[model samples]
Target: MGPETLLPNGIAHYLLGGLLIGAGTVVIYGATGITAGASTFLESTLSYVSGLPRFQQFRFTATRDWRVVFTLGIVLGGALYGLAFGEFGWTTDVQWWRLLGGGVLVGIGTRVGKGCTSGHGVCGVGSLSEASLLNVSVFVSIAVGTALTVQALGVSP
Candidate 1:
C-alpha cells in the first residue's frame, strides 16, 4: 500500500493498528496483569514441569493457576462486547452432533497446524511470521472449499 493509503487523518493506519493491539494488551494486563496468550500459558506449563531454569517461578505460577480466571474474564469481556454491539444471543436449537464433529475437527486442525485462528491469524500474523502466513492461507482455502462443498450438498440454512 502507498503512504497516502496508509495514512488516515494524517496518522498512519499501521500505527493505529499497533496502538489498538497495544491498547488491548494493556487492557488485558490492567484487568488481569498477566500475559493473555494461550501459547504462553502452555509453554509456561511445560517449562514448569520440564524443570527449565530459564522459566521463572512467578511466570509459571501466574500462568498455570490464573489462566482459568483469565480465560473466564476473556469470555465475559467478549460477551459484554457482543452485547454492546447487539450481537449477543442465545440459541436453544443447536445440533449437538454437528457441534461435536465441528469441535473435533477444530481440535485436530489446531493440533496439526500448531495453533488456532487467534494464535495464527491474530498474534502470528501481527508478528509477521511465515508459518502463520502459510497456516492462514491453508485455513482460508480449506474454509472456502468446505463452504463450497456444503453448498453443493444442499445443506439447509
Candidate 2:
C-alpha cells in the first residue's frame, strides 16, 4: 500500500487536527470555563427532554443551549468530513450488537471514572489535575491491554 492508502492527508492532517482540538479546547475553556467533554455535552443535552434532577442541574440546564451547538458541531464536522473525503459508511465488519455493547460499557466507564478521555486527558491534564492524570493512565493501559487480549483471542472485526 502507498502512503495515500495509509494516511490520505498525510501527517499534516493529523497535526492540524490536533492543533485545532487544542485551540478549540483552549478557546472554549477561556470563554466559559467549561471543558469540552463529549460526555458532559451529552448529559447537558438531556436536560431539554429529561426532567431528571441530574439532567436538570444548573450546570447542565443553564448551559445546555451552547452545549447543543457544540454537540451539533461534532456531528456535523464528521458528516462534512465524510462527505468531502468519501469516507462515509461502515468500515468494519463488527457486529452491531457488539458495537452497542461496547458503547454501553464505555458509557458506564465514563460514569465510574467520573469523566471521559477528552474531559480528563485534554482539559483536566492540561490543568494539572492529579485525578485526570491517573484516569488517563488507566484509560490508556486498559485500551492497550484490551487490544492485546482481543488479538490473542483471535478476534476479528
Candidate 3:
C-alpha cells in the first residue's frame, strides 16, 4: 500500500519516512555503535526535564561547547575535499544575525515539540510510536503554517 492514509498527510509522511530513517539508523549504529547525530538526543532531553533549565541541561549533557569545534572540523573537511577536487572558492557572505534568529526559533520549536525533527520524525517514529506521529504532525503543521504566513507577509527568508 502507499504510505498514506486518512490521517494528516504530514503525519503519514513522517511515519513512513521515520521508519525508514530509523531502520537506516539501526543498521548504521549496529555497525558503528556510535551516534549518527547528536541534535535529536540533545533536544529530547532538554524537553523532558526541569532543573537549571532544559537548554542549560542540554548544553551540559550534550557537550554543546564542543559543537563549534565539530562545526569547524566539518568546514575544514569540506575545504579539504573541495581543494582536492579543485572546487575551493569564496562563497556568499553570511548574515550572522539571521542565522542566530533561525537558531533561536529552532531551539524554541524543539522544546515545544519535546524533540527536534530527528528525535520525533526519525528516531521516535522509526520505532512506530503513536506519540511520535502526533508530535511530527504538530511540528510540521506549525512550521508550514508559519512559513506560509511569513511569505504572505512578504517577510524575506
* Winning model by lDDT: 2
**Superior by TM-score: candidate 1 or candidate 3:** 1
Off by over 4 Å in 2: 1-9
- Clashing pairs for model 3 are none
* Cα lDDT of model 3 by residue, 29-70, tens digit: 676453334454454354445455645554445544444444
Ordering by TM-score:
2, 1, 3
- Could you tell me the TM-score of candidate 2? 0.89
Tell me the whole-model lDDT of each prediction, alpha carbons only. Answer: 0.70, 0.88, 0.63
> Could you give me the TM-score of model 1 versus the true structure?
0.59
TM-score of each prediction: 0.59, 0.89, 0.50
Q: Distance (Å) between predicted and true CA of 68, model 1?
A: 2.1
On lDDT, the stronger of 1 and 3 is 1
RMSD of model 3, in Å?
A: 9.1
TM-score of 3: 0.50
The runs of at least 3 residues in candidate 1 whose Cα sits more than 4 Å from the true structure, single-residue gaps closed, are 1-62, 82-87, 91-94
